[model samples]
Target: MDIKLDDLTGSKIAGLINEHLQGMALNSPQESIHALNLEQLRKPEITFWSAWEGNDLLGCGALKELDPYHGEIKSMRTAKEHLRKGVAKKLLQHIVEEAKKRGYQRLSLETGSMDAFEPARKLYASFGFEYCKPFSDYKEDPNSVFMTKELFKK
Candidate 1:
């Protein structure tokens, strides 16, 4: 799969992001849903990427700059038909590399704490993200699990 910078203007990515938000709603409480919509993902602070296999959209992820040295992982989702196919892992690796290239010192993320989000939590943990208190503007929510990893800490 090829990971490419995405501008978030394509209908295919929009539909996938909608699908992700819809799924998040079904799995988490309304207040704990932090997944960004297309407009938010298009913000100047966020860099979005899409993974494709030629003409097929496989997965996507984004890095949102919280500050000059800190970044947040956002909007990670794999196509429903491509679940368990390593598409997400590849996209995530790409995002992490991009974060390091940008000189970020840390990477953080917020995901659901419920059983429905088990796969996501596990995925993050495997990537070295450890549980932490909320970062950025996030508040503690029982439905949310906050995690972070030091990318280039001493």
Candidate 2:
């Protein structure tokens, strides 16, 4: 798979992001939905990426700079047909590598606490992320789960 920075101006990426947000809205309460829309991801603080295989859009994830030393993962989603095919894992690995490249000391993410999010939590766990309190503007919400990982510059 080829991973590259996404400009978020294309119809395909827009559709994917909207789909992700829609999925989040369905599983989490209105107040608990934290997924960003295209305009939000286009912010200068956020770096978005999408994985592709030829013409197929496999998955996508984004990293938001909380500070020079920290980043928050966002917009993580794999295409429905590509689920369980390592698409999201690869995108996540790529996002982490980008964070490390930026000299970030930590990477964090927020996911749903619902059963629909179990696979995502497990994926982060496999990458050594630990459950953590809400970071940034988030607060304690029973519907949300937070995870973080410390990056070792290699």
Candidate 3:
């Protein structure tokens, strides 16, 4: 799949993000739901990307700058047609590479603690992410699972 930097105007990417937010809201508690809407993801501090194969949108992910050396993962989702096809893994690896290129010393993320999120947590773990305490503007919430990975310059 081709990973392309997106300006968040594509309706496919926007729809995927909205789906993620809706899923998060359903399974997570109100206080622990940190999923950003399209408006928030369009902020200058966030860089969004969409994976495509010709006219098809395979998946999308984003990196949110938390500080000079830190970044957070956001809006990761694979299209229904692309599920179980490594689309998410490809998008995640691309985002991690971009984060390292940007000189982020570490990458972090917050995912739901529900069963619906198990696949996501597994994907992150395979990339060497480990569970950690809440970071940035986040506070401890049982419904939220935080993970972080240290980046090595490549």
Candidate 4:
């Protein structure tokens, strides 16, 4: 699979992001949905990536620079047909490595708290991300689950 920085203008990425938003809507209330839209993902602080296998788009993920030493994971989604094929895993690994390369000391993310999000929570846990309080501009919401991993030991 080839994973690289995406400009988010392609139809495949746009469709995938729309699917992601739709999935979030299905699983969570509108107010509880924190997933960024394409315009929001294009902000200067965010770096988006897409995974591809030849002509097929496998998955995508993004990293947002919250600060010089901290980053936030965003928009992690594996294409419906590509589920369970390690697409999300590979994208996540790439994001983490990129965060480390940027000299980030911490990497954090927020995901849904519903049963629909169990797999994502487990994936983050497997990466050594521990449950944490709301960081950055996020607030305490029962529908949200916040997690963080320390990239470098102090």
Candidate 5:
């Protein structure tokens, strides 16, 4: 699969992003939905990427710089047709490698704490991320699950 930076164009990546946002709206509360729309994900602070196999978009994810040494994972989504195919995991590993390349000491993320999010949590756990207190402007919310991983800079 080819993973590269992309714009907010009308493509399968954009469709997957919309699907992810809609999924969040359905499973998370109104105030707890931190997922970004295509326009918001196109901002300067965020870098978006889509993974594709030939003409098919497999998955996508983004990295948002919260500060010079800290970054947050955003917009992680795998296409419905490609679920359980390691798309999300590959995108996540790419994001982590990119963070290391940019000198980020840590990578953090916020996902749901509900059953709908267990698979996501498990995926994150496989990457060495652990539960942590909320960072950035986030506050305590029962529906929110915070996690972080320290980069080894290898």
Candidate 6:
């Protein structure tokens, strides 16, 4: 699969992001939802990417720069037909590699704490992410699970 930097203008990417938002809403309470919308994901601090095979989109993910040394993962979603095919894993690996190349010392993410999110939590843990307190603008929320991995320790 080819993973490329996305500008959030394509219809495929937009639809995938909308689906992600809908999934978040369905699984988490309104007050605990932190998933960003298309416009929000387009912000200058965030770098978005989409994975594709030929013309079909497989999945997408984003990395938001919190500071020179830290970054956050966001909007990780594998297309319905592509679930369990390692699409999320490839997208996640791509994001982590990009963070390392950018000189980030830490990578973090927030996902739901519900059972629906178990696979995601397991995926992150497999990549060395450990449960942590909220980071950036996030506050403690029972509905949210935060994980972080140190890429380069000082």
Q: What C-alpha lDDT do the candidate models reach, one value each?
A: 0.93, 0.93, 0.92, 0.97, 0.93, 0.96
lDDT: the better of candidates 1 and 3: 1
lDDT of 4 by residue, 1-154 (tens): 9998999999999999999999999999999999999999999999999999998999999999999999999999999999999998899999999999999999999999999999999999999999999999999999999999999875
TM of each candidate vs. truth:
0.98, 0.97, 0.95, 0.99, 0.96, 0.99
Model 3: runs farther than 4 Å from truth? Answer: none
Model 3 steric clash pairs: none
How does residue 63 of candidate 5 score in lDDT? Answer: 99
Model 2 C-alpha lDDT versus the unseen true structure: 0.93
lDDT (Cα, tens digit) per residue for candidate 2, span 52-127: 9998998899999999999999999998989999998999989989999999999999999999999999999999
lDDT by residue for model 6 (7-61), tens: 9999999999999999999999999999999999999999999999999999999
Backbone-clash count (model 3): 0
lDDT of 1 at 56: 94
Candidate 6 displacement at residue 4 in angstroms: 0.2
Residue range with the least summed lDDT across 10 consecutive positions in model 2:
145-154
Lowest lDDT block of 10, candidate 4: 145-154
Q: How far out, in Å, is residue 88 in model 4?
A: 0.7
Once superposed on the true structure, which residue ranges of model 5 sit more than 4 Å away at CA? 152-154
Of 3 and 4, the candidate ahead on lDDT is 4
